[model samples]
Target: MHVVMTSAGIGRIEDGAVAVLDAPYPDPNTVIETTGSLDALGGAKVVRRIPLDGDELDLRAPLGRPRALWGVGLNYHSKAERTGRPAPDEPVLYLAGSSSVSAPGAAVRLPAEETVQMDYEAEIAVVIGRTLDRAAESEAWSAVAAITAANDMTARDVMKRTGTPALAKSFPGFTPLGASLLARDAIADPDAIGVRSWVGDERRQDSSSADMIFAIPELLARISRYAALRPGDVVLTGTPAGTGQDRDDFLRPGDTVRIEVDGVLPLTTHVRA
Candidate 1:
């Protein structure tokens, strides 16, 4: 089942029909309150049923504001090769502010600086379901609630100058999360999924979660050792090779970045440079 956040409430879409769940805003609360528990996401209380075929619904970000937005860098060998950086033994984690998230369709508004060299990083974002602290790799997967597509938009100039990832990528609307979230139960295999992206017609990234240097289970377990992960906390799996930086082809006005996680809706972000 797909979980969507609309102005009305949380929407559960399945089998061509949508059941509007009677819940509150921000997925962290909605998942637990209406369902009484995050683990049983399917048990949410439905307020109304609407056929998705001809319905027009105003959707919002599945996670209104993630409590913690953790990003992994150089997790893919291809990305490491492209950047001429060695793949790290452990997941390279950086924290971006929760306010960076925007609706899937929202435009990436660029800063007015003339040196702006905006780039796109397509990532498979994992949203934690239950709280996990010092969890083991074997049990880390169980704490996952859902998966979503994300564009980890970055300002290359800022990163190149200050060498601080959080500052470069934490701009408002930099993180375009999702149009819909795919529950973990709906995926046949959470560990293996296709992740790709495009800059208008040019396909830039083509990779799989299976190609990650540090897989999901290890990433979660590794992160939990230092900090606790709660519901709605997001982990941005590293983007693959073929970013604009590889060719010095930064984003400009009218450029659209489209990213996809196999099975979920494609995330599109227009550029306003």
Candidate 2:
């Protein structure tokens, strides 16, 4: 199922129509009402409907406000290599504030005098559907509800000054989320999802989850061992090699960054100062 947040409500892009869900947008009840089972959305009544391609709608972040956004660092071999560092022995994790979440078509306003070296990381984000505490690899997938694309935008200046991934990446509108979300079951191969990113007219990253050193199952299982993963929580599975930091390039006003994750929605963000 392809889920989207429309002005009317949470809706599904299926059955040749954009069927508005009876569940309200930003309400966790839709999933929570069913014990965090995203499959329960299949049973949600359609309050109303619109043409799938109609212009009478506006798209918002599919999840509205996720409970948390867990960012995984150096999870991709190519990404680590880009920094001339060896792949880490463990998942480098950071807890980004959910306040940074932005709608798919939103604009990213660069912080004034805080940082100008903005960068983008194209990543595939996993949306949790259940409460998982110390889950095993075999149990991780079952805890997942959907997959979405994320532009893990970073303010490199802040990171360099603070040396904290979470703080550096949690600026408002820093985490560009989605225009659509794909139900987990719709994906045949989670491990091989293709990920790509573009900075303005230039293509910056071109890699897939296949290049990730620690896959989703392992990442989720490992994280669950320490922190409880709950419904509406999202895990950003690091980006590919090519980034502005590696190329000595950074985002500037008027630049547009686009990220696409195969099997889910793609996102585009316009940069502003």
Candidate 3:
């Protein structure tokens, strides 16, 4: 099932059809609090069937307000090789707050004061389905509910200056997430999903999750040990090589970024003036 949250209401794609649920936006925390678990909402009753049109309604990020938006850096072998950095023994973790989250077709506001070198990182985002603490690699995938694609927008100059890239990456609307969330069974093998990105007409990043230095289970196991994972906590499985930085091409005002995960979702964001 392709779960979707929109201004119209909560909806899901069932049997190649879209059905709107008779409820407001399903916030992960609120759902868990009321229903005992996120899984309980999977069978929500369909109230209305609406005609499908991409431009008809406003699509919002599937997770209403993610508790923690975690991201990993240098997890791709090709990305590690390009920056002349060795694959870290563990995942290079970073945090992007909820404020950074944005919906598809939204505008990413450039940092006016410190807008030096902005870049786009196409990544696979995991949506946690349940609470997990110190979960083992064998049980990591069980904790995931859905998957989506994201663009981890960054201000390279701000990162270089503050020595913490999170400052650059967590700016308002920096994280553009897909509006649709594919169920865990949507993909037979999540580890090998395709990730691609484009800056207008130029394809900047094209790679596969198979190239990740640290796989999904490993990342979940490591991150869970340090931070208790809850439903709706997003984990960005690192971007592949060919980032704007590596290509010596950075985003400026009036630029558009489109990122896609072959079997999951695709999202686009525009840099505003």
Candidate 4:
């Protein structure tokens, strides 16, 4: 079932109608409530009448306020090779401020003072469902609720000049995530999906999750050792090799960036000054 948490309400996609769950799950005040406990509420009662139109509502991040936004870098073998960096034994993690979260179709503002090497990276994002510490690889799957497409927009020039990539990556509106979060059960194999990115009509990056050096399970296990992952926190798996920075081309104003992942939703955003 495709689950979408929007400002309107939580919607579940069914065969014919969309089930709209109440505002807060497992609560009585919720106009449309689901059955079972928080953990066991698996599509028992669905609130019908809600529309599936992706528009008409302001879609916030999958979660209202995530504790932290964790991003894995150079996890893709090809991307690592392009950057002249060897594949690491573990995931290379970076922190993006929670305020940087923006929804699909939003405009990504180019930092005027920074260099003009703004680039786009398409990635698969994992949404954590429960709080966990030292989670084992075998048990990590249970902690994830869904996966979505995310564009890790970056300022390459600023990163190179400042000597800190995180500085450029953490800018507000830098991460434009796709709408419509696909439930974990909806995907049969998370590691085998295809991912692609486009600048307007031209394709930029094309790759698969199978090429990831450290897969999702292993990434979760390793990251959990350092810090506790709270519910609604997101871990963005790294992008593929074909980012604009790899090709030495940057985004210009009025450019449209689109990302599509098989079985997941498509995310599109425009570049603006």
Q: What C-alpha root-mean-square deviation, in Å, does candidate 2 show against the real structure?
A: 1.9
Candidate 1 lDDT over 87-124, as tens digits, reads 89878889998899998678878875724788899999
Lowest summed lDDT window (length 10), candidate 4: 28-37
**Which pairs of residues collide in model 4?**
22-32
Candidate 4, residues 109-131, lDDT tens digits: the string is 88878768889999998877766
lDDT of each: 0.82, 0.84, 0.81, 0.75
lDDT of 1 at 226: 96
lDDT of 3 at 34: 47
Clashing pairs in 3: none
Query: TM-score, each model?
Result: 0.91, 0.93, 0.92, 0.86
Estimate, for each residue in 131-237, the C-alpha lDDT of model 3 and write its tens digit. 77999989888778778889999888888889896898988899988857777766788687899999998898999889999898889989989899887788999
Per-residue lDDT, model 3, residue 193, is: 86
The clash count of every prediction, one per candidate, is 0, 0, 0, 1
The C-alpha RMSD of each candidate to the native structure, in angstroms, is 2.3, 1.9, 2.1, 3.8
- Model 4, C-alpha of 1: deviation from truth (Å): 2.3
Report the poorest 10 consecutive residues by lDDT, candidate 3.
28-37
